[model samples]
Target: MKRPAGMSNQALEFIRTASTKASWQEKIILLEFVSGLRMPDIVASEFDLSPVMKNEYTRLLIERDSGKPIDLIIGKKPFLDFEVNIEDGVFIPRPETEELVENTLIRLPKDPQIIVEIGTGTGVISLALARKFKDARIFSTDISSRAVALAKRNAEHLGLSDAINFFEADLIHFSGSEILKGKVNLLISNPPYIPSSRIPHLDDEVRLYDPPLALDGMDDGCSVVRRILDLSIDYLSPDGLVSLEIDGLIEKPLNSYLSQSTLEFKKGVDIRGNLRFLYASLHENSFSIQ
Candidate 1:
């Protein structure tokens, strides 16, 4: 491939060599390195005009060639309008999860008094909610201590430390559960929904880098989801809502389970048109389905 006008020979040569062994979005990754911009901004800017820090850019190229995700290589990821600090072993938030947050925002009550988030990996969902509902007392929990710590830091960095309460616990098992029971206005999560058997088939960057605790959903992938649903019965308010990001393959079984439960359920597709989001509310206060 002919080198773009302003790209250095070193960068061009590295891309040429790495292309033989690995497949990546070369242009986007390179733009991120040179311009210090997130993917969305990188796409709009002229890459050739962006100044590249040669040594750091070379190091990033080497890391990318070794199959590390660019987010990890850079140690940060953009979610919504803010960037969150990420660490090794914590599950990186995906674009789909951002969509989950936006959809939840639309369906949530105009002014929720209390909100609970299960499996708050990176705390992006809770952070967004705290920003949107400034007065809402938001409780976010994650089983991984590292994730909880990192999430707390992210909150502090965004000046949201006072708005969210981060804790280390599995699902809704935190010490403050008594305070949340029957009072949670909204409960949301992008929990681990990938089946155990499918983990090996995931991309190398995801399977090798992301922690298993954030990926495995056990035998059928609905274990965590089921637990969350059961817990919601006790935790959710009379008019509360439950929104979750789920794997499309388990829709039928989950649908069957929801049918038997007291919550009125609805499912929606992601940007790709796959059924990926599930929303439920107590039958007494059904969703104003849009």
Candidate 2:
């Protein structure tokens, strides 16, 4: 739909600059993204927005001018079969990661004992696992304290507080793997896999607003993958499988890491059909092909 008559291109440009470039519904969509308030409710309400809501909206507009993701302002993001709260500075789950989760879910054992998820941002994977495997115990960890708290709240609200445990620790350094030990039947993660040099070139919402701790994967983007693979060696059950999200560009390097490990892997394609997941299980033979 074209802009209304007499509305100068400059005015339309300003609106487009502030939000998306939708033709007719941009304004309404912007309202939905920022506040999650229905158009009818907002139009009919006689009560005023709470002082907190007013301040949040003001800050949201300022953030928008600078290109923060609207999901950050809306305080939530929908992930495979669920909605996860996304607080400021916490990483929002991307649609591409859903492919990783789906592939893992399909491979899960019907009566698995324990599952461990590293870098459990917003508990999207762990919570999803809980819903699928009600008898399985899940343990999830994140280096960010804020992410841990938010994930915990999400689990509680979903009535999964007892089924999942949230931990504040980095998988790269955590050594208490003996708690689950060799009983962990599955390991999963969507860790930082963005090459460090490429991070600065990402969109402002990703480079500026998405937490750096969750996006920077060091020089080659396989640093976290390497560390987590070593971590899984100690925690996985004999038949345990590990699944991870990775950058398609680093497939060779990532496969190299798999070559040195004792795990056999099957690659996965993402929503865009690019190979972006590595699902592996223990292989008795050492030094497999890259």
Candidate 3:
């Protein structure tokens, strides 16, 4: 048996066969992962997979073949300017949500006293706000205690723990103090908006790995969105804005909701140019949707 660094090819063939569906290149990726060594570091070097490394390589390949998201496999996802660790059952951040944050930043007040984010998975939106408005009181809420705890950890890691507050609430029936009602200068959310019907059709990587709590939005995919809009009617301060990340399927219905509201309506597009966000402000004047 030919050997490089005392590793037998016949032994390598067993690892390859054990991977089931992973290709040769994928095996190399898995090898590099457990080796903690990049391709540049491994080139022309005496490379041998340690026992622990070999075990981990096989484990990761098995998980990968079983449809786990690559980001979750690595346990980290990059959003905007920083990488956030992913916990089991927490939704990984997506690029569309980053576009939502960018749009919100553009529309925010110069110095908002209070900002509230609903369904703040992993604190991505809130963390961005904390960095943008250093003095602002940022309030983030999630229905899942586990998600809230994980998000808090991410905030603390970024040194924004003292700058932001995280809370767990079932918003549908939440009964908090008036501080959030009519006092919030800005309200933002990337609520669950994927229609229940569409969930089964989602890619296995998402349907099988991402938390349903962060994806399902009932029948039309705007049930939670409607609730948020109702809350904003009373919660948003005068002249304040309500910004949301929405499914493309909800645009027409959302437009109708915005048209009836006392707040002025503004639409935004994501990086791919899809109508992915809706902005509303307390106003009487009319403006065309852009």
Q: Which candidate is the best by TM-score?
A: 1
Q: Measure candidate 1: CA RMSD.
A: 3.8
lDDT of each: 0.82, 0.76, 0.79
Model 2: lDDT to the true structure: 0.76
Candidate 2 lDDT over residue span 158-218, tens digit each: 8899999788989834556577766778889999998889998999778888899999998
Flag regions of model 1 displaced more than 4 Å: 1-56
Point out the worst 10-residue segment of candidate 1 by lDDT.
Answer: 42-51
lDDT of each residue in 201-283, candidate 1, tens digit only: 99999999999989898888888999999999898888899999998877766877877887778788889999889998776
TM-scores of all predicted structures: 0.86, 0.81, 0.84
* Per-residue lDDT over 126-223 for candidate 3, one digit per residue giving the tens place of the 0 to 100 score: 99889888999888889998889989999989999999888888652345646578877788999998899999999998898889999999887888
User: What TM-score does model 3 achieve against the real structure?
Assistant: 0.84
- Score residue 153 of candidate 1 by CA lDDT: 94
TM-score of 2: 0.81
| Clashing residue pairs in candidate 3 (N, C-alpha, C atoms within 3 angstroms) | none
Q: List candidate 3 segments past 4 Å from native.
A: 1-33, 38-46, 172-176, 284-290
Instruction: Pick the winner on lDDT between candidates 1 and 2.
Output: 1
